[model samples]
Target: QCIIDNVVDLKVQAAITSIVSATLAKAKLLCQDVSARGALVSCPAGYKPTGCACGMGCGSWDIRTDSTCHCQCAGIDWTAARCCKIGV
Candidate 1:
């Protein structure tokens, strides 16, 4: 009886582990698929970047890329003041 109980518990544990592993693998695939699309492109031309890419409703503009004046901070404020520098 003890042996049978132990075997059943082991099998249940294995099954739970397999399910968790499969869920994690599926989540990984989904993330890869999303990232393949790439981050949002610079703010469309003519349209000045509104609301901090940092997500702040409004405040100072955190210049995105140095060359261009676009940014996608993903709502995360920049640690440094400058997002990008102008001129070669």
Candidate 2:
């Protein structure tokens, strides 16, 4: 049997930032591609994460009818508001 010493192997926040950035970048590329093709781009302007809820919260980025990403909080109805992506 072997034991391991507890040590900070990596900066979690920094890693998270990097991962998010890259993910957004890739998403942007995909959006650009769709837009370039003159296709109707849903949520062209992009939406921020907000208002999460255990009930229909999805706890993650959700696409509203207006085509926007929203992280709804507990008891916050995302359907209440629309993203309204411009130039879509």
Candidate 3:
């Protein structure tokens, strides 16, 4: 009984740790994205800044040369986006 209880406690701790780590990583990525966008917005025209590629279909809008702009919804249908069906 004692051994089982210890194992269960360890499993709970591991799950909590994993969730915290994942949340931190996501926050960090969001911060970086905001910073990059701010820099792009502040830059003047013809000024080139390099950063992550646009996620949507706006590939022509060069991140290096153009100001910061989010990808349009027309490009990718994220609403219909799916990961995996049941049995493929």
Against the true structure, whose TM-score is highest?
1
Which regions in candidate 1 have their CA more than 4 angstroms from the true location?
A: 1-4, 28-88
Winner on TM-score (1 vs 3): 1
Candidate 3, poorest ten consecutive residues by summed lDDT: 79-88
Q: Which stretches of candidate 3 lie over 4 Å from their true place?
A: 1-4, 28-88
Q: Provide the clashing-pair count of each candidate structure.
A: 3, 7, 0
Candidate 1: tens digits of C-alpha lDDT, residues 1-88: 3798889899999999999888766652111000012223343333333233322332334445532232344553332222221221
Return whichever of 2 and 3 wins on TM-score: 3
Error of 1 at 11 (Å): 0.4
> For candidate 2, lDDT tens digit of each residue in 36-84?
1111123435642222222353454454565434444544343322222
Note the Cα lDDT for every prediction shown: 0.39, 0.38, 0.39
lDDT, residue 14, candidate 2: 71
lDDT per residue, candidate 3, 1-88, as tens digits? 4798889899999999999888766652111222232212223333333433343433433232244433333443221111111221
All candidates in order of lDDT, best leading: 3, 1, 2
Report the Cα RMSD per candidate. Answer: 14.5, 15.1, 13.8
Task: Give residue 38's lDDT in candidate 2 (0 to 100).
Answer: 17
Ranking by TM-score: 1, 3, 2
Clashes of 3: 0
